[model samples]
Target: MAKYSRIIAQAGCHIHHAEPAQVYEAWTNPELMKTWMFLSGESRESEAKADVTEGGAWSVVNESQEETYRAYGEYLKIDPPERIEKTLVRKETGGQNEKIKVEINSILNGSQVIVTQDVVFLHHEQLHPKTVEEHLREQRRQTEKYWHEMFSLLSKQLTPS
Candidate 1:
């Protein structure tokens, strides 16, 4: 078998106060995205002109004080309140290259939600420094924290009147 460069990372959290379907809705809704998806200090927004269906295209922009990172991906699989799989592609100077597999899953407990992600980093050699294992590791940590914070914010914002 041809040895493919494999990079695996996982992150999970228990949202003890929210429903899995709520989480899923927030994830797929662009309006909800404007409220919680952006981190505390960053100004991020997403423009999703398509549905979250199989073969659908979506885009997200992560904006910081100095720069913005734009990303696009095609929904490969989507099961509401359960799982979402997509082929994530990052924008490069020349074209839309650098593809990776991103999977997001949700588990529920009463009113709680547990979200997990399994990402496979492919085409490692195309990176600037060849491999970004270390950067990716740090990104995983920061991203986990980011999502946790986002859910917290969502919980607060969505509380009943």
Candidate 2:
């Protein structure tokens, strides 16, 4: 038996008034990350630890959540304010087993972040034979809407002479 899972989602925002650098900064910056990714008002804080070099380690920590996700992967490709690609995996899950690659691109008037997640089921035998396809689809829909709202807020703050 084989185990496989794939989910692709496309979400973008148009900050016609802000430069790509500004949008990119907001995307990668730790402060901005907490603002959007964590909303529990738990005083979420993160240390960038972003070398952003071709081959470097990137890490982030969420104190409030009491969780940490880190990765060590080479920058497959990077075009300033344009695109970024990397191979990553979840820590503390287990021994190195699965790999996830994420690519983000900057689009006209703003940027587009597309996530392609591939996961391998552990102990594929014992798992039930049920798939949450519709549930995942719904989740993607809600997430797209959420991004739209966040981008709207960013635009309001960014748009100015």
Candidate 3:
């Protein structure tokens, strides 16, 4: 078989202070999403809207100190507090098209959220597996960092004053 691209980046964490449903809501609820959505370290969300149903549309405007842009897509699958799969688009991705699958499961006293992005390759050239793996490792690390930051923000919002 010919390889067009190799893309697999995964990140997850166990938040012992939040429940599965609460963690899921952070991704499905537009309002909750706005609180943690970040384009950069100092960036914040300007707008977020989602229908939260299969085939429903979702969009977010991420504003950083340097720039602002919109990322929009549709929900491919939504399974309550267990899982969600959706398409995501960004300018730098070249509409490379990707499916972001978020899985939430109940843990000891909180929740575990795992996010995986399947990046679609645009170029039709065959790349070496080692090369692909190295690239994915860096991407995975960066993605994991972002998710952790987002979750931290969500946790703060869910905490009592």
Best by TM-score: 3
Q: Model 1 — which ten-residue stretch has the worst lDDT? A: 93-102
- lDDT of each candidate versus the true structure: 0.56, 0.51, 0.76
Candidate 2: count the clashes.
0
Once model 2 is optimally superposed onto the true structure by TM-score, how far is the C-alpha of residue 79 displaced, in angstroms? 0.9
Q: How does each model score on TM-score?
A: 0.62, 0.58, 0.81
Residue 86 Cα positional deviation in candidate 1, in Å, after optimal superposition: 1.6
Please tell me which model should have the higher TM-score, number 2 or number 3.
Answer: 3
Candidate 2 segments whose C-alpha is farther than 4 A from its true place: 1-4, 27-43, 65-74, 91-123, 126-161
Please give the range of 10 consecutive residues that has the lowest summed lDDT in model 3. Answer: 119-128
lDDT of 1 by residue, 1-161 (tens): 11123334444555544566776776678777556654446665444433689988866666777677666677777877766666555543123333433233443542444444443333445565445666556655765676577667766655554
Q: How does model 1 fare in lDDT?
A: 0.56
For model 2, how does the per-residue alpha-carbon lDDT over 1-161 read when each residue is reduced to its tens digit? 43444344456655665666776665456566444432323535645445566665555444557554343444555566766665545442233333333334556665454444333333344455454455446645764565566556656555675
